[model samples]
Target: MRLVPTPEQRELRDAVRSFLAAASPMPAVRRAMESEPGHDPEVYRRLTGELGLTGLTVPEERGGTGAGHAELAVVLEETGAALLPGPFLATTLAAILLTETGEKEILAGVAAGTTTATVVLDGNRALNGAEADVVLTIDGDRVLARTDGERRPLRTLDPTRRQALVEPGGEVAAVSAAGIARARDLFAVAVAAEQLGVLRASLEAIVAYSRIRVAFNRVIGSYQAVKHRLADMHCTLEQAESIVRYAAWAADEAPAELPGAAALAQAYLGRACFEVASGSLLLHGGIGFTWEHDAHLYYKRAKADEVLLGPPRVHRARLADLLEL
Candidate 1:
């Protein structure tokens, strides 16, 4: 099958890249990382209002842009490249879940960029502990809890996206278990697609750096040792891309294939992306170790995203079970 993105998808990717270059350049990312909240609300407002990015995947009837997973994937890839701060991924996933479940009010706010939500997949895997206006949980069924403000900071490798701990304080709206499963699955596919973007950009950055930096009066990239390492990184990224595309397609069309595809993408891309980012940092030598270098920023994001939904090893084991291997 042809794995290339369509012309429209390519255009979407270019548009997102262009916007990020101007609104959230490398320096902006660094500054945001150091600032409180670790994100610029102004930039987010521009992206959501002007670019209509916040509603890319919501249905058109709900004030959304009426796009699909493929289109959302393009936005994610650019976000990874620029390390754009804010809860874009979290809010996007949350919106997808709410829209899929027919949570009209939540989806409407998401489309309007008024309500920001995030998933709490770490620690307890309980949604009630997720700090949001509404917390989606699955306990024999899916439930939405409206709670009081309770947020605690989480120490993270990626400072751009913050995490927190929350507690349920009041009653919640309950929904069917099937809906919860569907929402979780969609979130998994989106997260995997985002990881693919992170892996690809990390690979490209490292390859470009290796080809230019000279050692002993010769380009390091010319050395067999450096070339081989880069070759491996490229191979891993391609494999990750394959799985990511498959997952995105499955999420959009093949319902039966989503679980396996999600597991496969998360398994391969999660570990591979981290390796690629870390390897890029190492290829930069001492400079990569410094906070001033952008390599570490990608590295931190890779590490954080790897465990966002679940770790590579967990997904790999799940894949093994799904395939009955």
Candidate 2:
């Protein structure tokens, strides 16, 4: 029911932000994007081993820190802001699905960061599947571990996050349909949290730029046109934060509400994030269009995220169906 982060959650957020500032800076992100694996292995190792981030949401019995979605949301937001490259999101999604299906051994490896995984969604595609140690596919009520599947890397808009086409094969276990749905709802909400982070970072960047940039012998931020757009961006950022938090809270405390909350989060946030990100780029003037600027990176990430979960319209349709509208 609480939309705001708790004190512990705030502390977690600050710690994560600090860690990312040092470990996943813009230079590091750029370097990782050009690398073969598309991520820095040493950074991943420090994140899991030092921060124990991989196990934040896993139960204590399952070799995790036993935190819930709220905590996970805190970490994910920081990762999104940093444009962190690696299998972190993919691994987290797999661990969550495995938890629902009672796949303890794989869950153990995921929690320990010894294994990375990705879920094969529609189109037989998976995020980070190229480097994943496990490929999971949800079929009817069963969650399968595709041991024999082939993974082919796909070029994507955001180089920081890799995608792959997977030929799903092999079956590991059976789980309830309800469990699968719940895990997916959690996944949807998690993506929303990341989008919110992108929105936040985009807004901050533009605002900072407006103050320093000169136009017509005056600070650009003082202009009526630029000021209005900044106001709009701030409004969108605030709304997105609220929606994403509600979805995360529902995922942890209100399973019955999570499906609708997740859908609503995606329906609104997917477009909103893209708007703010694009607006930020445009507001940055000529420099934003250049490859040297970080604005383009966030812009690409926002656009890619809009379709990361099957597009905003798909979520909107699901929300309408959930409401029986």
Report lDDT (CA) for all predictions.
0.76, 0.89
lDDT of 2 by residue, 24-117 (tens): 8999999998998899999998888789888889899999999999899889888988989999988888888988888788889888988888
Residue 35 shift from truth in candidate 2, angstroms = 1.1
Clashing pairs in 1: none
Candidate 1's C-alpha runs over 4 A off are 124-135, 169-173
C-alpha lDDT (0 to 100) for residue 308 of candidate 1: 78
Tens digits of per-residue lDDT, candidate 1, 231-260, equal: 999889778777777787777778888888
Best by lDDT: 2
* Pairs that clash in candidate 2: none
